[model samples]
Target chain A: MNNADHPTQSPGNVAGIRRQVVLPLGKSIEIAYNSIRVRFFRSLITTLSLVLAVSFLSFVNVSTDVANGLLATGQPELRQALVRAGYDLAPEDRRADSSSKQRWIVLLSLLVCAVGIVNAQLMAVTERFREIGTMKCLGALDRFVMRLFLLEAGMQGLVGAAAGALGGALFALLNGFILFGGQAVRLVPANELLLSLLWATAAGCLLSLIGVAYPAWVAARMQPVEAMRVEQ
Target chain B: MTTNKNIVRVTNVTKTFQLGKIAVHALKGVELEIPTGQYVSIMGPSGSGKSTLFNMIGGLDKPTTGKVYIDEVDVSQLDAYELAWLRCRKIGYIFQTFNIIQVMTALENVTLPMTFAGMRNDEAIEKAMGLLDLVGLGDRFQHKPFELSGGQQQRVAIARALANDPAIILADEPTGNLDLKTGEEIINLLQNLSHERDVTVISATHDIKMLNVSDLVVWIRDGRIDKIESRDELTISVGRIDARNA
Candidate 1:
């Protein structure tokens, strides 16, 4: 509160004050992390939904591959069942059909998970009206606000994707081992398994970024006065 | 530091809002000049556009047809990014709700603006501590907003508003949520900041007590300035009225 300590006007300081850099990336990410921590249950629910969807997708992919491989063994009972169902198809044809169907199912599941993410993020944005306003009043650039939300969504996506992939892989391994004993190891292509997990992770991250884009934009464009006037 | 030059100038500023196809005039060609290091209180009833005018001066909103100048620089001419820099470096805002980010500690809340201004983490923390101490909240640095009382929370908000060392502090009904005694303390704190630091402090308030401490009191009605008088003038007018009644 000392008068001398606080200068009323700094000589020739007008133009110098205008050259503000965007907020540091590290600080924005830290704020996003704190926000995620504050709303732990909400974020967890959104992430868990993502995990389930992703895991189901991976499971479809792995299970179809394993199923196709098992059919290739020329097991009489399985072949007879196929015959009873009037397929009477070769193992190669069945594998191709299953691969196409798995692709469709994975695509469908991702769509559903994307919708869930959008809903969750919208709700988050609505709840944080005052918080966003406060940030803006504190001189946060719009891009900084947008980046914080995108970073939060990215973090959730990464966690959910990793967990989902691992869960799906474990399920496939267990199901194969229970059914086909020593042959299960050979049927579940270890290399393909690694690639699918990576794909799932990438897909999850992309989906999250897309889902949060609208809400982040809305938050970034909010007028500070109007936002603060919103009833909490 | 005290100067005759006006730190803020509002020139026939008028603001209109389109609310559901109906035009509502919030400010009606209001003109005023706030000199450097002055404590000015804008007093009006609800819906008198005090808050709207405060927002214009603070650069939170633009006037519909008039200009707002801070240090003689026209605010309306600046782009969004420039306005943000102006808000960051030249003006601080305190709201009635004491809008501290609830998730952060008091110290963190105070440091947020500095952080946005690109201050390094260590320097920001050090300055934030000083601000907190200045507002008498040094002991509550680590406390969250929910853990503090209303007055304490408002003190934290005040510290936060001062974070960037802005020359102008715009407070919109800062004591609207506080009790009488706490409200007085906050008013005293603001007055002291104005007097000691040579910062221009402008507040919009319904509290009559604020008029006693303000160097100038502006009365508004229906989005227009009804009168502007110094505290001494107001006191003299009141004395004349009291003598006539007696």
Candidate 2:
């Protein structure tokens, strides 16, 4: 056969011979997609749980702060005084409703995310014992194996974080528009959305690492023979 | 590739395993030496510690006592990463189950060890193809492990084991899973490798038919060498010799 027909038969044939034949194109995306596909429903449930939990805690924190501030200022003499002092006794009806809902939503989302990460990592590790072994046998050190899991989890985290942040902000904005009828009810921190995204990603990784620890340990110590013996 | 005369040296090696409360002795004071480019087969019954011996020699397990030296370097003292590196650079391994990664194509499986050895992706892939071609699986590069038959898969495993151009190929029951014809083909291929590549082959097997093809036969019993035989000591041709003559 002609050399042209054999793509792997290049001038650097010897060098080409040594690489792990990773499939070119769509590998990273495919890996990410598959990881998400395996954990999507569970991750949603987790994210929702966490969102609710965090939101509730945040509301508690904010309300407690607002209440203390109002108390410190004593009772406001005028209706506008409370608003000016950042302690509207009546507050806009829509703002009150949304702020209340945000508590539960944030808590729910956080719980959902944490649980989903644990589940996904556990499943991924369980399913790929042989693959891990093969990598080890091929001379992969502990750090390399850990890196693979980290990368996979990191990708999943990015996806989940982006989606949660966007969805959450939209929900918050929708609540504001409906309640205020296009009027302002204090400032909405746009930067918090970015912060939330970053936080979600970091949390996703942290939770996944916790889940992956045992499996990664097992893999790191796995004898090449045991890995080879595992049934597909 | 060190041009070392003594490739593998084993001295007073002992291995034991704790299975619950009982301690199972796998190898006891085993001392052996394998020179470079030797083709040897280890034969034994099940539970005879032949597998354990192979594992130790392949650097997959550390002996409880004594030391293993490959290319005159003591392997027992090396750290995990260094030991892994030694396995990657110095030894090739073939398993009875083929042990080809299911998620990877044949070429990928073959090239995987080189990747761990720090070879670039392109170089490893190209070399993997060449090795596959050498093992007569050139056209099946993209075939996943499950897609191939037992014989085909074993060929892929052989290719994988040879990927790093290691001096020694450690095969544990290489043809134990194949039928008579396929097993013979594998044996022939291994024999050809011994002759052509001058690679040191250490295989553990129960296949009586393989004796004819082996340069040296080591019978292991209770983790000890019962008898060591060179090809000149054998008298009988067990099978197919008369047929071929006819």
Candidate maximizing lDDT = 1
DockQ of 2: 0.20
lDDT of each: 0.81, 0.66
Per-candidate DockQ values are 0.41, 0.20
lDDT of 2 by residue, A1-232 (tens): 2222112213353333234323233433453355455557754553443344334333333333333332343333433443553443464322322245555765565556566556655666766676666666666666666655655555545555455444544554554455333322233443544455455445544655555566556655666666646255
Model 1, stretches more than 4 Å misplaced? A1-21, A68-89, A92-99, A185-187, A230-232, B236-246
Q: In candidate 2, residue B67 scores what lDDT?
A: 91
Relative to the real complex, the DockQ score for model 1 comes to 0.41
lDDT of 2 at B229: 79
Off by over 4 Å in 2: A1-116, A171-198, A228-232, B1-4, B235-246
RMSD of each: 4.4, 8.6
Classify candidate 1 by CAPRI docking class.
acceptable
